[model samples]
Target chain A: MNCFKALLLLLLCTSLPAVEPVKLTDDGRMKFTPVFVDGDTRLTFVDFENPKVFRLKSMDWKTREVKVVHEAAPAPEFDPAYSIDGNYFSFLRTTGGLQVSLVIRNRKSNEEVVIAPEPGFSGYRTPAIAPDSSQMLFSFANNFGQDIFRIDMKGEGRTALTGTKGINIWPSYSPDGKKIVFTSTRDGNYELYEMKPDGSEIKRLTDSPYQDIRGQYSPDGKQIAFVSHRDGNAEIYLCNADGTSVRRVTNHEERDDYPTWHPDGNHLVYVAERDGSHDLYLLPLKD
Target chain B: MLNIGSFKTKTCSGIGRRSFLQMSGAIPFGLGMSGLGMVTADEVDHVVAKAKSIVFVFLWGAPSHLDTCDPKPNSNSDYRGPFGVIPTRTPGVHFTELLPKLAQRSDKYTLIRSHIQSAPGHPDGGTVALSGFEENPKPVKPNFGSIIARHRGFRGKLPPFFSIANGVVMDGGRRIEAYGGGEMGAVYDPFMVGASETGKVNIPALALMDDVNPLRITDRRQLLQQLDSVPRTLEKSKFRDWNRTYQQAYGLITDPTARQAFDLTQESVKTRQRYGQSVFGQSALLARRLVEAEVPYIQLNYSRHVEAITPGYEFGWDTHLYNFSLLQDQHCPIFDRAFSAFLDDIYARGLIDDTLIVCMGEFGRTPKINVRAARDHWPQCYFSMWAGAGLQTGRVIGESDKNGEHPITRPITPLMVGTTIAELAGVDSQARAEMRVLDGGRVINELL
Candidate 1:
């Protein structure tokens, strides 16, 4: 489960040009949650200047062009996600500093409604839209515990997919919509887990002592990439769908997190810390 | 034997054992009368100390020191956080912009930037910060308030020591170790006056049942005393233990002073508005009233529970998630408004010279922000603001490194803080010996 492919690459040759991680954005602001790259090589992320003014910006890898798809909604908005068809967008908005509600907007109608938590729900974070854009899955924590849940776009058909006794977060749907991958602390420390859409027959993917969060599947759904703290600091790592052939992706001293797979599945983009500023970087997985 | 042996003995200030005996016109040096034994004025100078009372605002969850008293503006974005630095009334001293009010009133307090409590875990750190010792070795060290209560005893109708909250400070499942009597015994435990955000005061320890009124409480007390009169076969029983506790509760319920002190309606509309309507704000107002009531020691807990992640939930200084946002939106603004008004009210009311005010959290957040865009717990360095109690005002003591990670000057530990508080509150050497806590605790000479 713990294979150091990068160490092997280093041992094989010392003269090869360094696999430098590419910087995508130079802005020193926070790279908000839910930074993802779609199948079209277009990357989307919330550029957080502050709660009052944040923008969901996207950059095309092929053309090197950037644009803001939407401005953050009123109040503090975080973890923005765009629907596959680009008809709807979803994000988490906190009222006060505590009660969190999922906000979904219909682009065509210019209408928005807030999905508040049930009576005992206390916290919500990292909302992700389904591939079909019909349902949204997110993680919510209460006084009792934390788990992941899925709800329809109309605020109906809410289901607790993973109701384990520990924190489960960052649930992402596979491209085909048949499987879901997420990070869970149910086994003491954060590790990746893969399960069916309904959350049955779960299988542990990466078993590392340190935190392994934001486990995302590739566009082809053959591999999973996540951020691991096994190296004493957060760095990106990739593993096969069956939890084998683990390999390190991004190697940097400062913290690197939220890795998103490119359309070609051979490249990965993630937020990396350089000199105290957080910026997105594109890594070429050509080794 | 007048059966007054259980009462608090040992005269303090100009009151207590000697005063009670003198006031009662009892025979001098009567036999079989025993309690705190005997003490000389020289041994009990702490009783006549400068500070008549202390209001310890324990910010249970650690706030980021970089964002509070010790701001590093020259440091880059990572260490400086999101807020900018503002000049304080003290020349060359600046605090994060969130604390503009505290900044303006900097002339009234001593801002110590090199405070450190080594335990990073919430419960351990909170306990040490509040009590000056670790929670291990069975019974933990008594809190500063408990020690003060033990030596000073009750002054009037009000309890000697009081905590403002339903319960003591807790983080998740663990409570702070020094929240109660600890090694000094349960008699020193604070009589808590709980308050919600709406400014309602409820005393859970003394709260009578819905059907139990003042008359009913009296009836029950009489019945219990009657039952106690029926002599038991067991010769060594401590059944009479309820006498002092019951008397205190009855006095609180019936005394107009106690009720009036807790009543917020008595405050002027402008005064209440100045403190703001948040739970912490109202609690600060309550602390001022308690001071007027002459409570020797008061622990004004900012939050009932620590580690509150969401806004509408219980509030604490622990900002593990979204540290900057929460501070900007809720924690900082409330503290800035309430604390500033509290300082002004204390000074204007002429309580400043006698009443000691100390505000601080258990620890502090890390120097560098984490990947989650929030700061984690860093116990190496933090800050505390001290005012009144004859302390040197408009002064900044000690300094942290450039990044505010570690103290560059002499580090002030919780032990020093407890020692200073106890010494100023008038807990003399004799009382500290009796308490048996803070054995090696030394006062911060610079503070005095």
Candidate 2:
């Protein structure tokens, strides 16, 4: 009986996910919209330099060296996304007075396509590039709540993906490109939902009373990582691709948000606030 | 006028004569000197004082009244926005889902939804909100904090009035003209201090003496010993005055208890965690410390700038665009947690009875959703949260229309806010008359 109990204790301890997260950056500045690029050798993210400037920065994953991705401009740019082949990049740039335009630039041609809202207090948010780089998905305010919309590579052929009664945002395509997962408040309170590429057969992924946002598919498309506030404060949480077996990844009292999946399916890189200092950390997960 | 002299001296910590004098210049003893000459009123009528300290939490950018405390669940979606209303601890009082924590703590504070501002734009609105008067008429009035600070006079090492923020509050590039002493002259300007999310307190005036980092110095006695070596080159009487200024500066810089009051590290790990580690959160904690230290007034700012999405600006409550998104993701979460913790701490420390706390913005956002699906400036109606200071609690003080477009009940003006604050802080009508401040201001009788 003692030997059996010892084996059970060992199994339980080994099965528990690793609670210790390794700190990656120590500069302690606010960072947002982190994405892995260049075959996972570099990380691209937005760094807020001041209230008037947000610079897109790329870090060499190996040496930890950081550099700006673009020359300084008057308008602040953020919410960056890159095409799967790295041939195209998309981001939101503020024009003026609550107006933002989604700019998609083709690296090969240095040509750009811009999608802006009608003149007034309007802007696009969180552009997600399709896997084939043929389309871009973003959210805009419509009919009193934000709705997801997709535009082709040339910023044409706009189509409403999901028009709900509440906010529907942070849409990203699965690796396979057959389905899209996003956060929505249609049912009241932010929750994760998935639907086909054509916005059909929508299915709820999370049912938390609090917010569950920033959902992203793992590189291999088997898992999803997101930020949820169900456990009191905002923390990183993970669920299966089909939204089963949800588990909390971070338990800190401070906020842990903006979770982006590492190229490897077993880890996530997220912005974590610890002891009042916000920095990026690599959190490992157990199957 | 006393001429500042050039005297060479060095501290044990290697602070040179230039740095020492620079540090002294940052002390603002000249302002305090002027304060000392003001005649105290011999027979002024004084209101029964309930609060010893006042924390004027200035939410710089106006927040939407309908989306927050005055949620109109019965209204159309255009007016109600995306958030659902949640029941608060106070019966029939409801807030949006974005403020669950504050909703649960409703019993701790009174909510006023019938407040209105005189100005629509940020700079003018901010001036009106802080000083209870418009700026265009010239000779802008002193801030309520300034009025209270002058009435109380200087009594401690810490400045009687402190504005805890990154810098002077601004809207775009324009600074509110009535941010400080106003007509009272710069001498009565509240001392400026900035607190980072990590509890790193920065005295901006002290930054003039960058070479002398008083915050980095742990040994107060050693620093004081080093300061004693300055050469006394002036005549005996002049030297005596200079020495008094020096001692005042030294007392503020090297007083361990004074320094400790600004130190967030002195707080336990759990305590700091409760504040949630944001700029506004840590600043709220610092304001609580200032209150505990008996500072007469603290202007705790939410952000330095009014624009929420503008680069280089901290996120303020002005939600002209992406109002619902910003409120859901950033402003509301940070505010709900930090403010709830602040209220809990104030009550836990038994400071509620003697500390008057007022949290409000310059104005409120538009009741009707704008063309961009966001809210814009609306001076017609707004809301404020009041607690502590032995006042009533767990009740709604005023009412707004069903659309939150106008105050259906008696409109509470900014002057009424200033008058009520002053009344609670013991600045009665006679004191206001004597100071030539808050002219024709009347207290919100319903609050009393």
Candidate 3:
């Protein structure tokens, strides 16, 4: 009887989802906007050098070794995304003041295309390249409200996909490029919404009274991962592509935000604050 | 730089010994020197010393009054923004949903909604906010903290005034000229200390030399032995005077009591967790510890810079772009958890009665949403939160118009703020007259 009971306990513990920290940043600087790259072996993210400087950094999950992706610059460079073929790279670079420009580079050709915002307090936020690398989508703020816009590889043929009265940001394309998921506050507070690549057939994904932001579609396009404050604190949550079968992934009292899906679709890399220190962590999803 | 002990140290303002001596000669050092018996609460005349310590929570980069504390829910969507309002502990008072924790704890403090400033930009506004005077005239006035520090003098090992931040607060690259002592000299400047989100305390002025391992700071004898080895450079008479100042500076790190006061490791895991784990949160906890140490004035800054979304910058309340998103995702959540924890901790420890807690920014943001769908700098109106030091709690002291554009009540200027803080901290009108500071300032009678 005792042997049988011990076996039951072992099976239960082994079946539980395992979460592992990618790196322990003890310097009190924040690491945010993690993106999986290099076939899931490496992750790229933004790191705060000081209170005034942010740089792009990449680290190997297996070796736990980190490297700076871009050399230090006066302005901050962040929100890095890579095309499916790894031939196209894109990120947002702050010009001056609050204005930011999206830069897209063809790694193979060594050519770049830059889309700078008009003058005044405006900038591109969270640029996500399409799976085919044909176009790049990002959010820009105007006098009325913020909306997502998409531009081709040559920074031409710009199209505004969202024109709501509130903020519509953090647009991410599904693996097949059939659907685009984003966060919007048009209905009231921030909530996740998914629409066609052409901004048609819009569907509200989550209806939480609180904020639900930074939505990213999984590699398989079967589920979406996002950060929601419905429980009074920011935590990671997972829901189906159709916005059903919602389940909480993290329940820490502190914040667990900025969820980015790994290439495997079975895991996520995110920024979590534990004991006042912010670091990246890898969380395995349970089926 | 003065090479005392084993390492070279600079003053918080980077003033050298000669400059220090020159300033000391100009001002009477008797009141500021150490070894004087503690000035008891009863010793102050006229105005009672209701508060023995003042924690000036400086929220740099003005926050939008409509989005956070002073909500205009009934206004148009453009003016009101996208946030919903919730009722606070004080009846008929509502704050935006971004500040749920603070709203719940409204009974613990008083909220003032009719603040106005002269300067529309950060640099000039910050100077006026800190010194109650503009930077246009030569010899800008001393910061409110410097005024109280000079009045209280030094009562213990810790400096009378402390600015808990990574460095002096700045807007972009321009440091606030009025951040430190103005005409009063650098000797009256705050002792600069940096506290990380994890509660590690760093004294920038006393940074160790590269050769010395920081872990060895705990060993006083070893540190002093290295200090003794430095070759004498000054003449015997001058060296004696320099040595006295050197010992006093090093004493801050060597003294056990002082070290304990700055050490966040002494706090329990639960207490640290309560404060949340952000730089501002940990700094707020450190400010509480300084209050316990009887430091006369502590200016705990939210961030050193004013810009929020700029690269290489910490999130200040300057929400020029992405105002609602940043507030929901970053600023509000961090502030709600950390500040609520601080208020609870201080009250639980029975320190509220003698600790004047004032939290506000240099100014408020624009009431109307801007072209970017975010708020811009608006010196016309803002708000402040005051608690402890015998303040009437659970009440709204002033009112703003329906649109929150201007004050419906009498406008509360920065000068009045300095006067009220000084008066509560035992620096009476007569004392202000003697120092020739806050000359025309008057206290906010409603707060009393």
Q: Interface RMSD for each candidate model?
A: 18.2, 7.1, 6.2
Instruction: Report the lDDT tens digits of candidate 3 across residue range B154-217.
Output: 6689888899888777766777878877887666778888776556677766543334443457
Please give, for residues B1-448, the per-residue lDDT of candidate 1 as tens digits: 0000110100000123243223323322122222221111112222236888899998867888987888776776556664546778888787776677788889999877777665667887777888888787677888888888878876689888889865666665567778877887767778877664435566664443233344334455664554455445533323332445555666765665666777776777667657754567778888999999888888998886322334223338777664655575457766887899899999999999899999999888888755444577887788898999777788877667789986655667798899889888877666687768678887766566
Off by over 4 Å in 3: A1-29, A71-75, A201-203, A244-247, B1-48, B85-87, B207-251, B305-315
lDDT of 2 by residue, B122-170 (tens): 8888999999988978998999999998999878987788898888888
Q: A160-246 in candidate 3: lDDT tens per residue?
A: 998756778899999999999998877876788999999988889988766788889888899998887777667888888988867
Index of the highest-DockQ prediction: 3
Give per-residue lDDT, candidate 3, residue A202: 82
DockQ of 3: 0.27
List the candidate 1 regions with Cα displacement exceeding 4 Å. Answer: A1-287, B1-48, B213-245, B305-315
DockQ metric for all predictions: 0.04, 0.23, 0.27
Residue pairs with colliding backbones in model 3 are A52-B312, A53-B312, A143-B371, A276-B277, B5-B227
Q: What would the per-residue lDDT of candidate 2 be over residues A69-180, giving only the tens digit for each residue?
A: 8886567788999888888889988887667888999989999988877776678998999998888899888666678998899999889989745678899999989999
| C-alpha lDDT values of all predictions | 0.70, 0.77, 0.77
Clashing pairs in 1: A97-B310, A97-B311, A98-B310, A98-B311, B46-B426
